[model samples]
Target chain A: MILGLTIAIVVVALAAGALNLVLGLLGKAPNDLSLGALALVELALIAQVVTAIVAPLVGNPPSGNPIEFWAYLIAAVVIPVLAVFWALGERNRWGTVVLGIAALAIAVMVWRMQIIWTVQLA
Target chain B: MRVRASGDPLPLHYSVSVPEARSSLATGLGRVLVIVYAILALAATGRSVSQILSRFDEAPVAFTLSALAAVVYIVATIALVAKGPVWNRVAWIAIGFELVGVLVIGAISLLAPQLLGLPDINPFGRYATVWSDFGAGYLCIPLVLPVLGLLWLRSRRDAARQAATVDAEVRA
Candidate 1:
């Protein structure tokens, strides 16, 4: 379940990031596609957070580095919020750039989380 | 003399300014540098702290380097975000060091993998610094950042020069 969600996060993030990369290069106005990509990443992150919370509750907690796990969790939550602020601060290609950065960060964290959980499974 | 916000003198140039106009050559790329730097700051700090707490005995040198990398990343990020002349200087120095550090350390780690080798050597000693294994861990941003940073600095410098020339012509 976690693996599937993690893959979903990466796919959505990469799609958004690639689109943002294109728009950012063209110097186009920030568009909803970028925003939608970011929103999808956020939704996937929220789901990951819920899974992380419930895994421990269910007594099947991840057995990897707890510090790493928590760090990933905190970063996942904070990145999107900070991104929204940064995106809103600029209306040009910069806004899309911000969204791209945030989404990329989310993807990395998701990958890290997967590594942590997989280590536990191993 | 211009006033700077209170912070210890950064050991190097760690701040830079955004160019007056985003060039077609560097628009997405510069933003990529900023994003990568932010992630490095977070990752390096996290690894350093965790290493220190979990196992400080093994690879003291590498872990310390990790911590230092974290500091540099934080400094670079601040320098990148802070605008103006002071920050531009700071960013230049910081990015310069970053490039040097990555190249030097990357070479050492790559040619001398033994330096990072250890199983029970220490808790995290079994692992390596960001420079270890040729930066295989963090996708080699350590190698890439300095190159990008240099480009970013040059772009900003060019913009500054252009602005100054325009100002001079207007005054004349």
Candidate 2:
């Protein structure tokens, strides 16, 4: 189900975030490992995008207007991508903050997706 | 031509002072602020425009407030990211307005939700601004950003003051 994938993504994102935080605390930004983690999260988000597209196609549409769903979905995909790219340009705690914001956005997107699903179920 | 530390004149490959070369934490953190504000700018604008265009008749008050909030965020982001003393002053003003807007709107939304409610087609039938429900949506960044912005500005000012004191001491 979409819920399962979302939970998995959240777990991956949080674990990666923890690693990034550790690197940040150690005063290491732009580390290979952190960048690797960011890459993984980005890949996972790609999976999310695919899932979002398939969700309504196969089943009842998620709640809200299609325009709204698609709009938020597009934002969901774009925000983290932009954050990661921008963060990669800098090698400091600021970069870590960028990752932090990306993770936070993922969480919000998942929450929104869940709400959309719930509205449909109702 | 530039003289090396050994006092032999060397070819001037590049001319720059140590002060100019040093990168401050503000530059780094300010960049971070820029990214965050940009995200908010996009989110607010998108939501407001969609609401206004898609369902202007549903909740005119809420949609209009959303549009206004988007404008404020956009202005604040631009002012904050612009480089120069003039932009710094503008950033302060924009952020000040943001702080006031959020607080006043948040309080009103909570105490008088009816004042902001807009009729809609679906069951929910109403729209709310970023300040509504204390920014329950978008994780309340609208509520949080102003405070962080003020703190960041104060630290920058403090650093500037310290630098000035050091300069005065050196001159004396």
Candidate 3:
């Protein structure tokens, strides 16, 4: 994983999470901006996943537990999708809160992925 | 407390008994709880399954405890999402068990890691259970979830009881 790209994703996710939390606190439902930010974060995660998968084929397999790394990768991709689905279904401020939590989790997951990648490289 | 008029025709498929007001487990804040529990359940299941399948022989006791924690999390997640009195009771039991399990496992892992076959010369040494080191791996969410779950369940039960009482008074 490229360090710069990983950091960017984490920053975006955290910002989105904070925004969602504020919206939830203000009794506002998840609006376009919140969803859009999440979409960007999701796209970044997809890019990370692609990079991780392709790097291994290029003889740069993660030095750490590959299975665990892959599990986290897959889970990171799934979290936002599930959160958006639940958020749309809920149609309330709490739905936004759930999205906030999802974004926060994604940020953490990305950080973990970066750690795993660095461990392998080192 | 107005009653239906006698002249008004009932639905053709109306049941003989009145259905109690449905109390859903996934409403408002409960929805957030459900999501949190579901995430934990997924995480625990993934971790335990991977450990057990890859190297069960290395630390059987710790892996088995991890599996047990996964099971408890899964049950609690399901119970928290399903509606009805039966499911409510199941949620209470599952959440209660989760609290007890986390406390016991946390204490054991911290004070007596050797008791659970700790210090194994494996990639993921001893403390493998979800409650190990108070869920240090997952940022202590496992340690805190059950307490929140129990409080949520209690409040919901009280609300349901209050609603039932009001309904009874209206009928009388």
Candidate DockQ values, in order, are 0.27, 0.37, 0.38
lDDT of 1 by residue, A1-122 (tens): 27787898888877777787678777865677777777777887788888888877888677776666666677677776666655654467776777776777677777877776658521
What local distance difference test score does each model get? 0.68, 0.68, 0.78
DockQ of 2: 0.37
lDDT of 3 by residue, B58-83 (tens): 77998898889889988988887775
Q: lDDT ranking from best to worst?
A: 3, 1, 2
Which 10 consecutive residues of model 1 chain A have the lowest summed lDDT? A113-122
Per candidate, the number of residue pairs that clash is 8, 0, 0
Identify the candidate with maximal TM-score.
3
lDDT of 2 by residue, A1-122 (tens): 27788788778777777777666666676666777777787788788778777877898456655555555566666876777776766667777766766666666665655565546421
**Fraction of real interface contacts that model 3 preserves:** 0.23
Tell me, by lDDT, which candidate is best: 3
DockQ value for model 1: 0.27
In angstroms, give how far residue B147 of model 2 lies from its true place: 1.0
Whichever of 2 and 3 has more TM-score, that candidate is 3
